[model samples]
Target: MSGGEAYVFAAYLALFVAVLGWLVIHAFKIARLSRELAELVELARRRDGKAPAPDAAEARVAGQ
Candidate 1:
């Protein structure tokens, strides 16, 4: 490819990589927040004198 075409391709590749990295970081952040929310819900339940809900592993086993 010519010089200008190479530069354009490089720019596009850089932009794509940046976007992908951002999405991955965002996904991780969401997962962490979900875990934190679940923990908070369980704590609230316990504070109210109720049994904490089954976790993911127990739920999966019960589903089987």
Candidate 2:
């Protein structure tokens, strides 16, 4: 391949890798947030002295 063709290929590969990395990072963040929300639901349940409701879980996730 010519030098210019090689450079273009490298640039495209770099962009693809960067986008994949961002997607993986975003997935991790969402998982972490979900775990945090589950913990909060447990806390709220203990505080209220009853089983947690679906609405309560939604509210906690919404930061209400």
Candidate 3:
């Protein structure tokens, strides 16, 4: 491949890697948020004297 073409390919590959890394990080953040939300719901139930709702993570963990 020509030098310019190699540079262009490298740039595109770098961009793809960055986007994929972002997607992976975003997925982790979402999972963490769901777990946190479940914990918050439990805390709210305790304070409000209501029954605790099912945790959002239970099904996902159980399926594994």
Candidate 4:
């Protein structure tokens, strides 16, 4: 293969790796935020002195 072709292939590979790394980082951030949101919801429920209700998804299933 020509040098130019090799360079092009390497550049594409690098771009693919960079995109994959970004997706992984974003996924972790989403997971962490979800956990924080759940915690806040629980705290709010406690402050209101209300019993915990089923999660929305769970309630939907139970309703069906």
Question: Whose lDDT is greatest here?
Answer: 2
Model 3, range 1-64, lDDT digits (tens) per residue?
A: 9999999999999999999999999999888877776677678777899776565435644354
What does candidate 1's lDDT look like per residue over 4-46, in tens digits? 9999999999999999999999989877766676777677778
Q: TM-score for model 1?
A: 0.74
Number of clashing pairs, model 1?
0
User: 1-64, model 4: which lDDT tens digit per residue?
Assistant: 7999999999999999999999999989877766666666667777899876548534443354
Candidates' lDDT values, in order? 0.78, 0.84, 0.78, 0.75
Assess candidate 4 and give its lDDT.
0.75
TM-score of each: 0.74, 0.71, 0.67, 0.72
Error of 4 at 54 (Å): 6.2
Q: Rank by TM-score, descending? A: 1, 4, 2, 3
What is the TM-score (0 to 1) of candidate 4? 0.72
List, residue by residue over 1-64, the lDDT tens digit for candidate 2.
9999999999999999999999999989987887788788788787989876767676666673
Which ranges in model 1 have alpha carbons more than 4 Å from their true place? 55-64
TM-score of predicted model 2?
0.71
- Model 4 C-alpha RMSD vs. true structure (Å) is 4.8
